[model samples]
Target: MKHIFKFLGIATLACLTWSCADIDKDEVGDESKLPNAVYIEGADVNPVTKLTVDAAGGKSSFTARAANKLGSNVTLKFAINEKALEKYNELNGTHYKLLPAKYYSLSAENLTISANNISNGSIDVNVKPLDNELDASTKYAIPVSIASAEGGSLLNSSVTKIFAIDRVLYTSSLRQNGFYLKTTFNPPYTNLQEWTLSYAIKLDQNKDNQAVLSPDFYSRVTADGGLQMKVGETDDPKAFAKTKLQPGKWYYIAWVYNRQHVKCYINGTLDTEFDVPKVETFTKLNMSWGAFVGYVREIRLYDKALSAFQVMDNLYIETPENPNLLFYAPLDKNTGIKDVSKNHHAIKVYTAGSDDATEYNQSLITWQDEKFPE
Candidate 1:
C-alpha cells in the first residue's frame, strides 16, 4: 500500500512540472513576436510640429508610420482630435484655436501597411493654405490621432500628434509717390503724459528736406536733415541734430516724450534731448509729403517711453508686438494696409496723382518687395 501511494504522488508531480514548462514556453513565444502598434515616425522629436506659411500659397505635410513587422496588411484610421488640442491648450495656457478639418487632409485617411512593407509604410498629413485675413500672431493647431488600427494596436504614448501653424507677417515696399498709411491712435494720445514713436525708414536722397512724418500740429522729420518735433502749433521745431542722413540707407528713428522732456534716438544712439513743458495731445501721423520717396517697414507707437537698450533690442525685430504699443503698421500688403494692434484702428491710404485727391486712394498705390536701404 505504501509503494502504490508513492508512485501516484510522483506521477502527479511530473504532470505538474510539464504543465508549468509549457506555460513558460508559450509566454516566451508570445514575447518574441514583434509588437503591432501604429505611431508617428520620430514622435519624440516631432511631437509638436510647427509650420510657417504664407497665407496665399503653399502647403505643409508630415508623415505617420507604424511600428513592427506584421504577417498581413494592416489599415490604420486617423482623425482630428479636438479633445487633445483642448488638453494641450489648457496645459500650455495658450489660446491655440482649432483649425477646421477641411483645412487638413491625409494622403489616405485609411492607410494600409502591406505585409512586405509593414515597417516601412506611412501616411501623409497635408495642411492647406489659409486665408490672408487671419492674424499671424494667433496660432492655429490641428491635432491628429490614430483612431483605430486593423490587425494592429494604436500606440498609447504616441497616438496623437499636434500640428501648429503660424502665418508669415506681410511686408511690402512703397515708393515716395505720396503713398502713406494712417491708423487711429487708440487710448488716443490726447490724455497721455508720456509716449514713444518709432519707425524704420530709408529715404531717397533726392527727396531730401521733405517731411517724413507729419501731424497737423507737428512734423517728426524735415528735409533740413534732422529729426524735428514741434510743440503744439509752434513753428520752432526742436531739432535732434543737423546730421544729414544718407539717401537709400536704412535708418531707425525713435522719439520718446514725457511731460518733462523729449529725446530723439537715431539707430539706437541718443542724438538729441530737450526739456519741454507738458503738452496736451498728439493728433496724427503722416508718412510723407507727396515728393518724399522711400521704404517704410514697421511703424510702432508706445504708451511709455522706451529705454535706449529697449530701442536697440527692438531694432532687429521686424514685427513689434509690444503690450505698450498702441499702434502698429507693418505695411505688408500689396494693396490694402492693416493695423495689427489691439485697437484695430482704421487705416487710410493716400496715393499721389489721384484725381480724387482724397486721403485714401487705392488707385495710385503700388507695392514692391520691401528692401531696406543697406
Candidate 2:
C-alpha cells in the first residue's frame, strides 16, 4: 500500500508542471495582454529629437497600446525622411557617420496585442549628416512614426527636442589670453551655466608642487575678485592647490557661485568650494580644464543653476569610456570630444591631425569669440 501511494503522488506532480508550462506559452500569443493606446492618422510624423553635429547618436523609447479593445500584436516602424536617408547613403560621403547616429528599425514580429495602442517597447538609435541646416540657431524636423502591419494603421507622432550645434571654429588653436570671472561685483549668473572653456592653464605652483583648480577660480580670476558668500575668506587665492591637469581627460569647468556658497565641479563631482563673503560682492573668478592647449567639445551655457542630478544626467552622453576621467578612444590616436551639451545645445571637437594643441575660449560659451585670432 505504501508503494502505491508514492506512485500516485508522483503522477499528480507531473500533471501540475505540464499545466503551468502550457499557460506560459499562451501568454506570448495573446496580444490583448499588451497595453497601448495610440493612433497615427496623418502622413506627417513628428520628430523625436534634433541632433547638433553632423555625426550624432541617441536612443528613443516609449510605450504603446493597440487600437481596438482586442489584444493583438502590432508592429512598429521608425524611419527618417527619404531625403535624410539618401544623404546618409551617398557614395564617398564627405560626411562621417558615428555611433548613436546610426539609423535602425526594430520590430518584435507582432509583439503587441492589446486594446488600443497599449504596449511597452524601446530602441537605441543614431544618425549621421542629420539633414540639418548649417546654421547653429536654426531648428530642423526629424520625422518618426509607429504603425501596425495587420491593418497598416499608424500610431504615435510628435516632435521631440530642438537641437543646436555651436558655430565651428575652423582654426588650429585658441587665444592664450585667459578670461577672468568677475564674481565679486556682478558675480557670475545662471546664464553662465552653458558657457564652456577648453584651454590649458599655466599654474603658478606652490610649495606642495600641486596646482590647485578652485571653484572660486571662475570668480577669482574675474574682474571682481570673488562672489559674496556665507563663509570663509573669498580672497584666499590659495583656496586652490598646484595639481597637475593631465591631458586626454575630460573635465567640466563651471562659473559656479551664488549667494549661498561658491563651488566648482570636475567631471560632475565637486572639486572645490568657498564660503560666502559677508560683504556679498566679489569678482575675478578663473577656471580651466587643460591650459594653453588640449581639446574641448560641446560647450554650452544655461540660464539656470543645474542641480547635481540634472548635471549628471546631461553629462551622461559623454560619460562613457570614462571620458570624464580620461579622453575617449578614437580610430586615430588623437582624442575625440563627445557631446558637451545634451538638452538643447552641444559642442563636439575632434582632432583631424596630431601636434597642434587645440585651444578654445575659456570665457565665451558660444563660438562667436576668437579662439585663435589670426
Candidate 3:
C-alpha cells in the first residue's frame, strides 16, 4: 500500500454546483437491513490517492456515498481543508504544499445519497496546472472532507481524503537489455563543438556504484551510494555530490556542453554550471553496460547547445520533429530499439570482449515495457 493512514478534519462548506433542495429523495430501503452511514467513496478500501496533472491539465472526481443504502436521503456537503493536508504531512513526515484554488475547483460540493442511489453525485476536482503553471519540483495535494451532513452520520472516522498531486511529463519508460544497446553515428561522433542530451528517469533502487545512464562514452554513476551524480571521466567527480535522485521519484535531466562550459538542468531548472577542460567529443561514442536500475523513455541528442529555455520546452514534446535532433529514443515501443529522429541510427549491441568467433556467452540485454509515466 502506498499509503496506510489518513487524517480526519472538518472544513467550511465549499461552493456548491447544485442546491440540495432540488435533489429528490427517490429510493426506498428497509431501515433494519440497510447500513446507516455516510462516507467518502473508496474510504473502506484504502487506495493510493495520487493525481498527476499535465500541462494540458486534468479532471478527477470522487463522490460521497451511504454504506449500503440508507432508509432515507442523506445530503452531504464537502470542501477542501488545507489543515488536513498539513496534518497528513506531519504524520507522514512529508512536505506537500496545498494546491492553490485558482488551479483547481471542486464540483462535488453537495451530493445527496438517496434511497434510489447508494452513491450520489461526485465532487469533481478539475485542475488546470498550465493555466497558471505549477512548480514541477515541489509536491502539492488537496485534502477533501465532508464538511457537513444532513439526516445522516459520518462513518468510522472517514471524514477527510487527501489527494497528492504530480506534474510528471514522462508517462512511459522501460528497463531492457537494450539498455546496453548502441549505434554508431552516421557522420560519426567527432568534432562536436556544441551538444545537448536530455534524459528522464525514475530511480528504481538505492544501491550505489551503479551506472544509471550511459548516453555515450560519458555516463553517471549512483555515486555516494546512489545519491550523487558523478561527472567527468567515468564516475569520478566527487565535487559534484548532491542529495538528488531519490528512488521512486521522476526527474528530467539535461546536459548542455558548449565550448568548455557545461550546464546541468534537473526538471527544467538549471542545477549545475561549471567550466570544464574540453569535454569528451566522442569519436568512438559507444558503450557496454552494467546493472542500471531506472526507467527511461525520453533520451535525446542534439548537435546544437540548447539553452535552459529549450531544455525546459523539450520536456513537453513526446516526439519532437526537429532537424537538429541527432538521436531520439522514446523507448516506449515494443521489440528492438528504435531511433525516431531523422538519422534513425541503427542500434547494435556490441561484445566488449575479444571479438573472436563469438565464444564467450552472456545473456543479451533488452528493455521491457513499463506503465505510462505517472
Candidate 4:
C-alpha cells in the first residue's frame, strides 16, 4: 500500500497583482469584441500530482495558469490532442481521462498545436513525467506562442531548454505485517482535520490475511467505546458495522475523519456519515483487511480529509504489473506528490525480518501535525 499526501492561494493572488498589472486592465469597448482583443500574455496549466490518474490507475497531473489582461473574464480554453488521454469519459458532454498516478514531464513531441497572429512570447515550466529510466532524454518542455483565441497561427514558439523531475522511489516491501509508518511526535497531536485513508481489504480466518490500508484504531464518536477499527466492530458507527465478510474477496473501503467532520465509503458507495468528536490521540494503531486476512495493495493516506467528490477521485482499481508492496513507489515525486509530514507525524511501519520478528524500515515520516505520535 502506498501512503500519500500545495500552495498558491491569497498570497499568490497578491503577488500576481504586483507583478502583472495588465491582467486587470479594462476590457475592449464592446463585450463581444472583448475576446478578440484578449491576448493571453501568460498562460500555464499544471496537473495536481498524486491525484492525477493514468491508464494503470497511477498518478499524473497538469497545472495551467493564464492571464487574460484583456479587461473582461473570457474563457481561456485549453485543448489536449485527442491522443493525450486514455480511459476517456463523457460526463454530460465534457470529456476527461483518468491521469496516471506517476509523474510525467510533457514534451513538445507529446503535444501538438496550431496558432494565429500573436508572436514574441516564451513558456517557463518545471515538469516530471511517469517514466524516466534515462537522463538527457528529457521529460518536459514549454510550448509558448503568440496567437489568436483559437490556436491557429504561431508568431513565435520556444521549448524549455532543460526540464527535470525530481525522482522519488517508495519501497514496496513495507506493506507486510508489523510494518507501521510513524512520524515524529506522540499521541494528542496526531489528530488531523484533513486526513483521509482509503484502501482494499480481504480477511481470512484460515490463512495469513491481507489488509490494504486499514487504520488499526480510530476514535469514533458514534461508537459505544468511542474507538474502533474502521469496520467489523459493533461499537463503531452503524456505517462501520462489520456484518459479514467473505474470505478471499476484496472490499473497497474509504474513511474521511477530521476535526471538521467524518464519513465513510464502502464498496464505492458513500454509505453513511456520523457526528464524531475530534480525536486528539490514542495508541496501538493496527489494521488488517477483515478479521486477520491481512492482504493489501494500493493503500493511500492523505494529509487533508477529502470531500465525497475527492474520495471518489482517489479510487483506482488498476495497479502496476508486479507492484511493490511496502514503501511508496511514486511514478514521479518531483512535481509534488510528497510526504504529508509538514508538521506532525504518526505513521510507524515495521516489516517482517529474516528472523520472523518485525524490522523497522528506519525511515520515519514525520506527521505534518503532531496529533498522534507512535
Best by lDDT: 1
- Candidate 1 lDDT score at position 269: 86
Task: Name the lDDT of candidate 2.
Answer: 0.33
Candidate 1 pairs with clashing backbones: 176-293, 209-223, 210-223
Off by over 4 Å in 4: 1-147, 150-191, 205-237, 241-246, 267-269, 282-284, 288-291, 298-301, 316-374
Q: Compared with the true structure, what per-residue lDDT tens digits does model 1 show for residues 167-279?
A: 55444655556665554454457766788878777776644355666643344445555656665555554545445576777778887877758788888788888866565
Better candidate by TM-score, 3 or 4: 3
Residues 10-99 of candidate 2: C-alpha lDDT, one tens digit per residue: 545755767645644645324354333444322224222334333343334333334445444555544434444234324212121222
Query: What is the Cα-based TM-score of model 1?
Result: 0.49
Candidate 3 ranges with C-alpha deviation above 4 Å = 1-171, 177-179, 215-217, 225-243, 284-288, 316-318, 334-336, 350-373
lDDT per residue (tens digit) for residues 254-299 in model 4: 6677774567776656766664545434333343312232344334
Task: For candidate 3, write residues 1-374 as lDDT tens digits.
Answer: 11111111111111133433432331122234334567777855642266767767877777777665677777888888787778766664455678888888887578787765678667778888554365443567878888888888787467778776756543335553323555567556666788887777766665655554554435554544333334445443542424367777777777788885777787888877766556545533333353556666677788888866457645634334566788877765442357878877776544434332232222444455443344
lDDT of candidate 1 at residue 22, scale 0 to 100: 68
Q: What lDDT score is found at residue 167 in candidate 2? A: 19
Backbone clash count for every predicted candidate, in the order shown: 3, 97, 14, 88
Q: Write down the RMSD of candidate 1 (Cα, Å).
A: 15.5
Q: Candidates' TM-scores?
A: 0.49, 0.36, 0.48, 0.38
lDDT of each: 0.63, 0.33, 0.61, 0.34
How much is 148 displaced in model 2, in angstroms?
Answer: 9.7
Ranking by TM-score: 1, 3, 4, 2
Point out the worst 10-residue segment of candidate 2 by lDDT: 325-334
